[model samples]
Target: MASSNFNRWLRPEVYPLFAATGVAVGICGMQLIRNITGNPEVRVTKENRAAGILENFAEGEKYRENPVRKFVRGKSSEIMPNINNFFSKPEL
Candidate 1:
């Protein structure tokens, strides 16, 4: 009867917190692995650095424009078509 009570405490409904804690630990482990393997300064060429900065700036501009486009014109459907097309495409 004591063992049965212990098993019942381990049931999913009673132990979601444990599962969530495990997931958080796993994510931290992966991040630690990434940090260990990642390079701090490989020294990108000036041209490549400029290109990367420009690309990131463009992405930021696009992200900032998204809400303005949606609210100003209210045309969410325009975005959906492109997303649908991306998912529908077959790789060559």
Candidate 2:
């Protein structure tokens, strides 16, 4: 019974329908996330810009930031000084 059920779902005839549904869901999810992240109405950057009706926090700040930017903004003193020295050219 279980094997029959599995075979019913795994039938080759349903591959195109499954593929289409998966792609549509994937696209919708991606667009939703993209709109959430990239929407300027929810972002606040300038002092004069009016705040969004639903915005309650620093959306722009979070949107513009990532791990690499956070690492670079930190005091170099907190990181290994030797790593900086390796990249910085010495003056003649």
Candidate 3:
């Protein structure tokens, strides 16, 4: 009985209202999650703006000098190199 009444109340004429309410609820839910996760919404500020620009310029310089080195560092490679050395062959 309750389900039938709910279906009757959700007529096609009220779809726009349902859609708007759904969008508002979704936006509020995302804001709640972002607050809980502590993610910064704004990246730029007066304190670090100049430092950020200088770092970007320095990175461009390094990229021009040695692209391969820059790629490795950018990927944060952490694999260790091999350590075994080969010995000289004995006379036959």
**Best candidate (score: lDDT):** 2
Which ranges of candidate 3 are over 4 A from the true structure?
39-92
Give lDDT tens digits, candidate 2, residues 1-92.
Answer: 99999999998999999999999999999868866667546444655255436553476566567556787785675366876786785656
Sorted by lDDT (best first), the order is 2, 1, 3
Model 3, 1-92: lDDT tens per residue? 99999998799998999999999999999767745443233235567544543435564554355645655775534353232212243346
**How high is each candidate's TM-score?**
0.33, 0.44, 0.37
Query: Between candidates 1 and 3, which one is better according to lDDT?
Result: 1
The better candidate by lDDT, 2 or 3, is 2
Better of 1 and 3 by TM-score: 3
lDDT of each residue in 33-67, candidate 1, tens digit only: 64444422222566654554243555455545654
Give the TM-score (vs. native) of candidate 1. 0.33
Best by TM-score: 2
Instruction: Report RMSD for candidate 1.
Output: 13.8
lDDT of 2 at 72: 76
lDDT of each: 0.63, 0.72, 0.60
